[model samples]
Target: MKKIIFIFLLALSFGCSESDSASNDSTGQGGSLAVFALKDNYLYSVDHMKLNVFSLINGEKPVKVNDIPIGFDIETLFAYGDNLFIGSRNGMFIYSISNPENPTKLSSVQHFTACDPVIANSTHSFVTLNSNTTCGNNTNVLQVYDTKDLKNPKLIHSRNLMQPKGIGFYTAKYLLVCDDVLKIFNIENPSEPILVHAIDKNCFDVIIRDNTLFAIGDKGVYRYKMNPNDIKDIQLESETNF
Candidate 1:
């Protein structure tokens, strides 16, 4: 378990490889229950089904904070500057995690039938929907929303993606979509989203900073510096994804 956690933390904090996640759990389903940003001191984890938070004062047992009852599973979470973006079948729950212990759920948005994960910026948020039931054809989608107003987040764009599982945002310019195909979008204009390129190989998780893209796939850690002219072909950086 320690080894796994260390690896995860490394993949997250550093530019190890393509940053993504996969389920090795018994149920073949593992959601990101907790996350702590490099800039923050406290740790935030989720109890998926309950949508409840587990806050750690230092690195101790997680203290129960908030409860979000979303029937399915709250698969992923992102701890941004001041807010906590939660993803589940219930909807996207935006909570203020500034007060670690007393997390207040500021708002909720039920846009898709199944919103399992989220990636965001100060002005925008990106969510992924993977459902076999209400989600037609089990097709994955990328839904962008305006989060300038936390109280009421408005939908900006919804585009279909293939095997979309996880996501992350970086540089405030690109939206990294993690799935069978790792995608990077030129979100220069939220309303007019352009898919500049994608690497359809092994990226399951993505973390980016400026032109540098880090992915965690079956290959382990993959790093690349994306070409502005051609995103599909990126300059490979030092990685252990072999």
Candidate 2:
């Protein structure tokens, strides 16, 4: 877990530079368990029950601008476009960041209590519910929602997995899901995701940058070179065990 966090922070710092800070509009990606996200010149974060907003306009010094009460057990934070998708033990919360300093709650969808981590794009939202941990319930499944209507998101599909954790988009059409192994799905049809490939690695989370894929699991941190043309052509680039 420590190694995963380290790699996530490293990735967050990689593309950011002096010019990025000067522009004050840098954005970064995080793994499934990430609690913070950057959008425009503002930094958004969530704790177990609160959503905090900080101003990065000063670059070096972050000013706490606002604090709003979110739901309980917030576990993950994902920023897409002008919206913030928050995953809590109970459900998923959607907030609009159109007003950078003050985010407005748009909508929320409840689910069974479990370890939830969520990610989203313009059309859909993906959430993984894991009951293997102490979060509660006996449900382990991936839930896909049609998010065209931000005010009312409907569950479009649900697929059971052994112990699904992190999820990411390898491309616009391909999605990477971490279960007992690393599963890659072709999401041509957002409602129905077809599993195309599975790597025999016990990954807990994954991060994709360009054509490079970084997966962290029980064994170690593994890096793979992705083939856009063929998913089967993905090759192992390196591995580092902690």
Candidate 3:
């Protein structure tokens, strides 16, 4: 499940700011799958059984403000504006973070039991459920949901995937990591994702910033130059194995 989190910290860190500087952003959950997300001066994280909230108001010492009992097997954490999206093996939990330190539960959408991670843009939220994990299920699927209403999340589209893993958005483009294959899609039309390219490579999680793609896998890290026009035209600039 640690392999399910990946997103650009530069984008997530500026939760309340309009600045686009990379240095201002930092990832609390540094794994492929993020279990921690920072918003404004508050940080929210989930362990196997609880949602932990921290306050960075003091800046000198991050204080534990709250710990909400959620459920078992919490896999991923993502923050969008005033909403916090939590993905567990059994469902997606939505929360309203209008009061950054105190998050209120909004709703929960249940799904087939599997290892799931989530990412979202302005209009839609994307979730990938993978089989062949400790979760004990063989259902691989990608779910697209309408996020216009934060309190009530409606599923707009569902497609069977091939061991889908970490997912992220590069503007209107969607990056999906499935096994060793990286798939790109243009999601201007949220309900219908148009396939842009499929690159054969070892990828578990990815972060795109400054027109460059950073993919991490068991082997190591790979750097690629992103070509929005033609994903095939994207060049692999460097590779470092750990």
TM-scores for every predicted model: 0.73, 0.92, 0.86
lDDT value, residue 223 of candidate 2: 92
lDDT per residue, candidate 2, 1-242, as tens digits?
A: 68665665556534542122122345665776778888868888899899999998999998999999997898898888788999999999999999988899999999999999998877999999999667899889999999999999999999999889999887788889999889999998988899999998888888877788888877688999988899989899999886
Off by over 4 Å in 3: 1-32
2 or 3, greater by TM-score: 2
Better of 1 and 3 by TM-score: 3
Q: How many steric clashes does model 2 contain?
A: 0
Worst lDDT run of 10 residues, candidate 1, spans: 22-31
Task: For candidate 2, give the lDDT.
Answer: 0.85
Please give the CA lDDT of all the candidate structures: 0.62, 0.85, 0.73
lDDT of 1 at 190: 88
lDDT of 3: 0.73
Give per-residue CA lDDT, model 1, range 120-218, as digits (tens).
667888877765454444647778899999989999888877667667654556667776677777888987788777776565566655576666665
Model 3 lDDT at residue 224: 86
Question: Against the hidden true structure, what lDDT does model 1 obtain?
Answer: 0.62
